[model samples]
Target: MKLMVHYTLKNKGLLFFNFICVFGFIIIELGLPTLLSQMIDVGVVNNDDAYIKKIGLTMLAVVIVGVLMNISLRYFMTRITTNVAASIRQDLFEKIQDYSHNEYEQLGVSSLITRVTNDAYQVMLFMQNFLRTGFMTPMMFIASLVMVLRTSGSLASYVLMVLPFLLIGVVAIAGFSNPLSRKQQGNLDRINNILRENLSGLRVIRAFVNEDFEEERFDKVNKAYEKSSKNLFRLMSSAQPGFFFLFNIVMAYIIWQGSIQIDQGTLEVGNLIAFIEYIFHALFSFMMFSTIFMMYPRAAVSANRIKEAMDTEPIIKSKENGVTQTETSGYLAFDEVTFAYPGHAESPVIRDADFSAKPGQTVAFIGSTGSGKSTLIQLIPRLYDVSEGEILVDGVDVRDYDIDALRAKIGYIPQSAVLFSGTIKENLRYGKDDATDEELEEALDIAQASDFVAELPDGLDTYISEGGANFSGGQKQRLAIARAVVRRPSIYIFDDSFSALDFATDAKVRERINEETTDATVLIVAQRVSTIMDADEIIVLNEGNIVGKGTHEELLETSSVYYDIASSQLTKEELGK
Candidate 1:
């Protein structure tokens, strides 16, 4: 994969040094067997004790050098592999962060997490093994073959006959295992998806009394993953035994032939012993090579997955030389804006929606479910770009502005409040990194969260669990609102943010927000009629089109859709007042 090349090249100098150490180790390994032949033939045949001691000390010195070189090689390999893995992970995370909402939906969060973690680790394992055993195997095999030939040509021929079978078996195993390895990685993704879903939806599963059903669902994927893993390991396991068997048959032939040569006084016992040692070295190297190749298929699959994530180009990207507006007065406008998610171009979720809001004005969108009210407001910040027409903020096209600059001017609170795992102060500080204690208190006061926060042990210092699991739903929503308020942006968006609060707290929070943000544009998407009845202008939508656009009283008098929504939540006397 290209990602592998990109990271491996980062430590090329260290990697080169590591390979040099491998070469040195191979030299020592090949030299030891040759010295053994000399020790037996020249020293023992002539009964020369001095020659034997000299050869023995030389072999010990070579062994010590080889051990030291192996240590250095391992140290460099570990550093290279670990750093490359970290680099790949960082790059993958940055690419994922740049993905637009559409791309996020295309690649699910669970799959991306697995790719960043498990797949990256797989590549690291391959690189480390390749450096340690992979390069040494081929060099050792060639050197051992030459030594065996110098010792006995007949035995070399027997070893040569076994080479073709070993090569063919290795190739066939790799070919058959590659696709299965890919499938195994895919199965792992499925298992992770199920695991994530079950954990996130544990409450819902218990509420619906579907625990047994969820267990059954989990079992199916788990069993499939196990089966795939078992099959892949089985295929890889066969290579080692097959290589050993073929080399063993060649060893039998060598011994039988060497016995006849010795009986005919044509081969010395020392040469025959050395030739057997050389055969074992060659076979061991070939076996190690086979094992390395077995791991390659799985790593290749993982590398491809990592490449896919790194290569995905986000559809929403800033243009080169994108304009940056120096000043924002919170003037947001939608000019005949229409939008559809990536695949449903035939039918827009919001169609030809025209609206405008100025500084200090509160514009509200009131609609039934699936009426595109939330989708319309999201376009102002370019969460998902409009499919047709344009959205302008501060009289400049949103597309023309750098995305970061444009988003800096807006504070968006989604319908579902999400908080990271941190202390309350840390979560609040996410909006404005330099915010002071006074600012936090004021924001909490405006969001009607101050009283509750003061009552908690440690107050703002209290640590929140993941996703704010430690807090109630209403408390989480209040903190979310306070977080946005701390930003003090030009525009404040409350997307049904008050739904979790009671009517009284909702009324007080809205009043406080109005008092504080009188100079900033406020846009709200709410379902309850009471929440938006006081909006300066309310746009009522049905399906994908605007059904009414006017003040609450004007809509009640002129539009039945608005009237029905108001009457459903309030009595006639209340609506009249």
Candidate 2:
């Protein structure tokens, strides 16, 4: 609930005006009943037609004023609530941009999407109803009760007796609703997560022939969501009827007793009419308030989920006033770096890894599947910081540099090729925003992708589908390589990026890159030994430890781990060459 208030503060002026509208409307509404009593008791009793006309005209003016105030209140509420929802979503999005991979993993992507979209909508819905009824009802109830007590104390006593019961019902319903709301939201997260997985992995599911299994899995969560929703609604569905029933019974008693007082000449007919009006206002307010109370629990649950994401500070916080530039480029060193993921501190994925690369050098790492090859290169970009030691870039600790400035110096191509839904030009501009068309063509030539891209009718203007689904795996990889080459960065990192291409294309791309990167450092991570056989230096990793570091010929005779890997992938003729 406080989450809403925090954003609501941005439009305090509108809120004040909205409050004025509600107050003015309540005054007009309460005043009309009193004016009606005067018209009936004085004008009708004395047969004064002029007096009746005057009061009737006055009542009409007040009604018109009340309608105007209501219209104003509704306008202010609509603007403020919409603005607040937008602000909340925008801030939440900015917060998400700052998150490191650790936060992304901690808060699942599907759940985060739900929070931004569905949860934000829930807050907006609650605000819409709340602004309309929340302020009006309580003040209306108290003011009308005060008037009722003044008009006739005996009738006011009956209304007071039911106050405790109504209050008790509100508290009890809210208490029961909160837990159900929490359960329903949790189930919704599960359904979204399952849906995301099913869509993203549709090919794998079809390949394995598991459609029925997936359907059953989806149905399990759907039914659970249905059950929670049904229970919550059943409780809500029964409440209005019960309240209305109690309302009818109480109204009957007040009217019957008032008629008796009138017959005895103890109560004036006009006074009795005004008393009934006040009682109606008070009870009607309680009815409106009851609806708000019913919605509060769900809104409160949604607000808490949004607040949790807002409160989460990213684990990797760079130095506030960090260095923005360096004295040199294409120089990197990892000094006795040992790192585990955030939780598994005792079991490191990279152990005591000391390495350095200077300009004009090509360093390649080869290892088995879980040998931490890709993880090691990721350290250079500070994707995940080293747990135990520091990594230096251009003779400065990476942590001491502005994070964005540090990333700007390197062009990294991850193992998975990613392309957004846009023309090739837009995707290439992501690497270097102001890159010229000639520069783009040159980068594509270096990556060996210009041949295919030139075949397209639109060439650079050809639109890519989401995740480059329209492109072949090799084509996507080459485009990703071209994207990195467009940057002409100080250092280039290709983490198993060439695995998708054939040997000839891979070799051609590497040869062109070597010609292009004469002044920049290159780091390659690969599973294929042929990929790194011509490197300036090759490092072999076994488990988390670095077992070998040397040129191809040097490692073949000296390091068993390197020899075993090279011998399995290279033919005797190629090895000899």
Supply the global lDDT for candidate 2: 0.92
Q: Cα lDDT for residue 144, model 2?
A: 96
After superposing candidate 1, which stretches have Cα over 4 Å from the reference?
Answer: none
lDDT of 2 by residue, 70-105 (tens): 999999999989988898899999999988889989
Show the lowest summed lDDT stretch of 10 residues, model 1: 319-328
Worst 10 residues of 2 by lDDT: 568-577
User: Once superposed on the true structure, which residue ranges of model 2 sit more than 4 Å away at CA?
Assistant: none
Q: Candidate 2, after superposition: displacement of residue 506 in Å?
A: 1.5
Candidate 2 pairs with clashing backbones: none
Q: Compute the lDDT of residue 300 as modeled in candidate 1.
A: 91
Candidate 1 lDDT tens digits, 1-577:
5667779889999989988999999999888878888999899989999999999999999999999999999999999999999999999999998899988788888889999999999999998998889889999999999899889997788888888888888888889889988888888888899999999999999999999998999899888889989988898887777777887888898999999999998898778888998899899999889888878888999999998888889888876787776576789888999999989999899999998999889999998899998888888888899999998889889999889888889999988999999999999999999999999999999999999899999999999999899999899999999999999999999999999999999999999999988889999999998999899999999998999999999999998988988989998798986
